[model samples]
Structures are given as C-alpha cells and as structure tokens.
Target: MAEQLTGLAGDRVLLGRTSTAERVSDILRSRISEGYFPPGTRLSEDSIGGALGVSRNTLREAFRLLTHERLLIHELNRGVFVRVLTVEDVEDIYRTRSLVECAVVRGLGEPPYPLQGLAAAVAEGERAAVDSDWKALGTANIHFHRELVALAGSERTDELMRSVFAELRLAFHVVDDPRRLHEPYLTRNRELLHTLQAGDRRGAERLLDTYLADSLERVVEVYRRRVGEDGTGAS
Candidate 1:
C-alpha cells in the first residue's frame, strides 16, 4: 500500500481549492474506481496519510465519505477495508441501471441528439477490444452507460449514476475471468450504439432493457458461485 501511494506522491491534488477532505475523497474515489484499491484491501491510515501527505484525520474523513457511499466499510476493531459487495448488491445495482438507463433511451432528446460522448465511449471500447485489454474494456463499458444516461440532460442524475458506476466497479474487480465477464458486452455495446445512431429509438430502449436484465442474471450467477451465500468468497 505504501509503495502504491509513493507512486502517487507529488501529483497535483484533485479539484484545486476544494476542502482537504473533499480532495482526498476524490483521489481515493478515483483510485477505487480504477481498481487500484481492490475489494477487501485494508487501508492503513498511517500508510495512506504518509503517502498522500495528509493527516490521519483527513484520511478518516475521506474513508467515511466512501463508506457512506457503500464503497468501504469500517470494522469495529480491524479498521477500514474496501467493501465486498454481496450478490444482493449486484442485483440491486442492475435493477437501478435498468430503470434509469432504459428511461434515458426511451425519452432521449430529438434529432441533433447529443451523441458525441456516446460515440467517443464506443470508440474507446472498440480500441480496448482490439488490444485485448479486458480491464480497460470494462471501464469503457461503464463510460458508455454513463453517456447513455447523460442523454436525459440531467446533471443531477448523471452525478448519481457516477457513484453507481463506481460501486459497480467493485463487483468487476472480483470477477474471476475478466474476458468472460466483459468480452460479450463489447459487441453488445457496439450493437446498442448502432441502434441509437440509426435513430431506432424504440429498438434501442428494448435492447438496453434486455441487455440489463441479461447482464444482471449473468453477474448474479457468477457472483453467487464465486462468493457463496454468506459473502465469504470461495476458498
């Protein structure tokens, strides 16, 4: 952990002029989303604070914020660790995504649609696939969904979904086979993108809704098998 932090040392602090806690939280959030802080990894205050050149108090505040967002959990005596999401969490996340993403596609704005973001994200996934970068492909998949939600033209909703995607990354980190989990989605995402690009709005909504449902089922099956009913990962 200290070595990891050392690499981040001397980097510009995020969101300049923000409060210390907020800035620390943003960096930590980005790290977690990037899969640097994998699920169940213990975060030592001394190590993290020393690495980031911040005080323990500030680090604790940042941890508290992430915990509130369900990205980390503090045990009574063992200290804070990245949260290990259960199968139930996966189901709920997909449910929320299905509702919100499907809604965005259904009510997408009229012609001259704001699709540059979506197109960029799709292109990113394609490049990742060409390089066989499974982890990056997964990240690009999340970006596509984020842009899809942006179609609704709601900053508040986009912010909410951002947190949702971060939590979703936790599940991704625990995946036993990255290719098995993300490869199929690469093609599906491209197909979905084309549907919208061709102005098949209705077809796009149905595809997205079905896509979320199928994804939820696949993730739940794999997750349950990997983690078991009580959330203790298979040993």
Candidate 2:
C-alpha cells in the first residue's frame, strides 16, 4: 500500500498549494477507480496521510467523502474499507448506465459528434490488449465509457457517472477471468466508435445499448460466482 502511495506523490503537486479534503478525495477516488485500492481492502489513515503529507483529520474527511460516494464503508471498530458491491448494485449500475449513455448518444445533435475522446479510449484499449495487460484493458474500457458520457457535455452528468464508473470497477476487480470479461468489448468499442465516426448515431446507440446489456450480464455472471449470494467474497 505504501509503495502504491509512493507513485501518487506527483499527484500532490497537481493539487497545487493547499491540499483540501476535496482534492484528497479526488486522488483517492482516482486510485480506487484505477484498481490501486481494490474493493474490500482497508484504507490506512496513518500510511496514506504520511504518504500524501496530509493531516489525519484531512484524511478522515477524505474518507468521509468517499464513504458518501458509496466507494468506501466505515465499520464501528474495523476501520474503513473499500465497498464490495452486490449483484443488485451491479444491475442498478448497468440500468443507470444504459439510460445515461444511450441517451447521450441519442441526443448527439449532429454527425461527427466529438469523436476525439472516444477514439483515444478505443486506441488505449487496443494498446492494452496488444500488450496482454487485461487489467489495463479493463481500465481502458471504463475510460471508453467515460469518454462516451463526456459527449453529453454536461458536467453534472459527468460527475454522477464518475462515481458510478468507480463503483463499477469494484465489481470488475472481483472477476476471476479478466480476459474473458474484457476481451470481447474491445472490438465492440471500436465498432461503436466507427459507427459514430460515420455519422450513424442510431447505429451507435444500438451498439452501445447492446454493449451495456451484454456487459451487465457478463459481469453479473462472474460476480455472483465469485462474490456469492451474500455479496461477500474471499476477501
């Protein structure tokens, strides 16, 4: 954990002069989304504070903020740990994603709707796949969806999906077969990008809707197997 925190020292400089709790939460949230702190892992205030050069109070406030985001849970005596999502939580996340992402595509006003971000995400996934880095591939997958949501051009929606995608990563972390989970989507993402690039908004929406539905089933299938009915896995 300390070693992982070491790499994040550069993020402190990114925060500029003062290290507010909001800035700390942003760093921690990004770490959690990137799989640095997987679900069910305990967060250490002492170690994280020393690493980030923040006060314990500030760290606790950051923890509190993340807890409100549903990415972390605090137990009476057990300290704070990353939240382990349930099957219902996964389903709900997909439902929310389908509604927002597809709507973003449907409302895209015109042809050639901002393809730069989506194109970049697809390329990122391709590079990860070529390297056989399934974990990085998964991160790229989320990036693809994030870029999709960005097409909406609404900061409120962006903020909402930011936490949703981070929570989605919690489910992805528990899947036993990362390749089986993430490999299939690379082509679909590329296809969707191409469809949008060609000015086929309806076609792109159809692809995205199917993509989210298929992905929900894939993740939930593995999620149930690994996490069990109680929502608690080996961790």
Candidate 3:
C-alpha cells in the first residue's frame, strides 16, 4: 500500500498498484474535495511534485486526469487550477440532475431503490452526517443519488451523473456547513423513498422534482454568495 499521506502528501495514502501519477492525482483530488484549495486556486507542478516526492511528468499526468474530470481547469500557459465554478456551470449541473434523476424515480417499480448498491450508500451518508465528516458526507451524498438514479439502468446516464457529482462535491468543499447544504433533504429523501416503496410513482416524481428545484436554488444562492456578482464582482 502507499504510505499514509500527510504533510505534503496530504490525506490520501498511496496504493502500491497506483503509479506515481495516479497517486498524485488522488492526493490532489482529495485535497480539492476537502476544500484545501478553493476554486481558482493555483497549483504549481514543481511545488507539488517536490512536496510529494513525485516528478513533474507524474504530476502533469495527475493534473490531466483531474482536468478531464472537470475537477481542475487547464490554462494555455498560466497553469492548471481548481475550477472557479461559475453560476452557469452550477445551473447546468442542477438542471441535468433534475432531468435525469426525476426520470429515475418515475421509472422505479417499488420499495428498494434497487441498484444492488444503494442501501450501503445511504448508510454511509447517515454515518458521515452523524460524524460530521463533510467530505465523506459529500461522497455519500453523490453515491446515494447515484444509486437512486442507477435504477434507470442506463450506463450513459450513470456516467454523466458521476461527472456532475464530482464537480458538485468540489462546490461542497467550499461550504462551511455540509449538512446545512444537504441536511434539510434527508427527510425529504426518506419521504421520496416511502412514496416509491408504496408504488406511488407519480407522487415520488413530483416530490423529487420539487425538492431538486429548491435544493438547486439553495446551492445556487450560496454559489452566488461566494462566486456570483454579489461576491466575485467580476461579471
């Protein structure tokens, strides 16, 4: 296994199977998700490589991976940095989430969310919320929605949703209160589950759509507070 990442290595440990580049990517990814570097924060190859005992090539590869994932933004010469998530990006994400997930709920037959991987995901979210592990909570939140929508059984949709969730988690890192960002929805999620479980597909879909709309509004408001005209003074 890779050494326990601390100091320059940060929170992710290296796994033996992972190449130096992969390990570097994981560390950088985790750090970004943990809010160590906010959106638009610059990353230096020499600095990160030297700190992690990696090489420029390896760190470059890592940056490429995150950039592809939309977790990092690459510039022509200025260098890569965490994406300064714009209101447009945030809105698009929520819009896609609603379009996709609302359909998933509408498609469900009954009871279990049935991804063969959902209950565990929900349990993890509850644990993170209980322990106040915001990052884990974010991960769990993403996973829960994944399982919820995986019921639609579409590989393409699953891939798209995962991409959106990764970017959303980066946003989550900036918020001071994780639960406040998501806590208000747990009961709502439970209610949706109950509605689905009762074979009330119409009710579940309606509820989910409204919840998603309001949830999107909340996050976008916070995004505005942090990066919109009210905050960035850029646009």
Candidate 4:
C-alpha cells in the first residue's frame, strides 16, 4: 500500500494550488475506480495523506465524501475501506443505470450524434483485448458507458453516473473471470456505436437496454457465487 501511495505522488501535483477535499476526492475516486484500491482494501490515512501532501483533515474530508457516494465505508475503529457491494446493491445499481443510461440514449434528439468518445473507447477496448489484458478491457468497457452518458450534455447526469460507474467497478473487482464478464460486451459496444453512427437512435437504445440487462445478470451471478448471503466478499 505504501508503494502504491508512492506512485501517486505525481497525481497530487496535478491538484496544484487549488487543493481541496473535493480535489482530493477526485484523485482517490479515480484511484478506486481504476482498482488501485480494490474492494475491501483499507486506505491508510498516514500513507495517503503523506503521499498526496495533504493534511489529515483534508483526507478525512475526502473519505467522508466518498462514503457519502457509497464508494467507501468507515468501520468503527477499523479505518476506511473500499466498499464490498452485496447482491442487492448490484441489482440497485443496474436499476439506476437502466433508468439513466437508457434515457440518455432515448433523449438524443437525432442521429449523427457526436460519437468520437465512444469510438475511442471502443478502440481502447480492442487494443486491450489484443494484448489479452482483461482488466484494462473492463476499464475500457466502463469508459464506453461513461462516454455514452456524456452524449446528454448534462453535467448533473454525468456526475451522477460517474459515482455509479465507480461503484459498479467494486462489483467488477470480485468477479473471478474477467474474460467471461467483459468479452461479450466488446462486440455489443461496437454494435451500439455503429447503430448511433448510422443515425439509428432507437436501435442504439434497444442495444443499450439489452446490454445493461445482460450485464446485470452476469454480475449478479458472480456476486451470489462469490459473496453468497453474507453480503461481503470472501477473503
């Protein structure tokens, strides 16, 4: 963990003079989403604060913000840890995603929508696949959806889904088979992109709806098997 904090020294520099709890939260949030701090991992305040060159108060504030976002949880006398989501939590996340993401596609006024971000994400997933890097492939998958939500041009919705996407990554970390979890989506993402590129918003929405539904089932199945009825992942 200390070594990981050491590597984040450069990330703190990006904060510059405007350092605040929100900025610290952004860095920690990005790290959590990227699996640098995986599910069930404890975040050491001393190491993180020292590495980021921030005060304990600032780091605690950042942790408080993340806890509010459901990305982390504070245990009594146990410090703060990345959240380990339960099966129900996974279901609720997909429910929210279906509501928000499908609406984003449905609300697009017309086709020929800006698709460069989606295209780039698809390309990134393909590169990761070619290299047989399944974890990177999953990250690309999340990026594709993030780009999808951005099409709405609503910062509020973007902010909402940003937390959702990060929470979704917690579930991803517990899956035993990244290939099974992410492989099928590679093609589906391309198909959805093609549908939008061809000016078929209706088709795109249908593709996304099915995509989310299927993904929800896949993830929940993994969660049940790995987490069981305990609501916590196996050690």
The 0-to-1 C-alpha lDDT of every candidate, in the order given, reads: 0.87, 0.91, 0.75, 0.92
Clash pairs detected, candidate 3: 2-14, 111-197
TM-score of each: 0.89, 0.89, 0.74, 0.90
State candidate 1's TM-score: 0.89
lDDT of 1 by residue, 124-197 (tens): 98899899999999999999999999999899899889889999999898788888888898788888888888
TM-score of 3: 0.74
Cα lDDT of model 3 by residue, 1-235, tens digit: 3554345365344443247777788788777766787777899888888889877777888898889888898888899988877777778888989888988877766555554465577677788778977667667767778888788888988877867877887667556566688776666766766676667889978998999899788887777776673325253
Error of 1 at 83 (Å): 0.5
In model 2, residue pairs whose N, Cα or C atoms come closer than 3 Å (at least 3 residues apart or on different chains), thus clashing, are none
Clashing pairs in 4: none
Mind giving the per-residue lDDT tens digits that candidate 2 earns over 1-235?
A: 8988998986786465345888999999999988899888999999999999988888898999899999999999989999999889999999999999999999998786888998899999999999999999999999999999999999999999999998998899888899999999999999999999899999999999989999999998898788975578632
Model 2 clashing-pair count: 0
| Candidate 4 root-mean-square deviation in Å | 8.5
The lDDT-based order of candidates, best leading, equals 4, 2, 1, 3
Between prediction 3 and prediction 4, the one with superior lDDT is 4
| Winner by TM-score between candidate 4 and candidate 3 | 4
Worst 10 residues of 3 by lDDT: 8-17
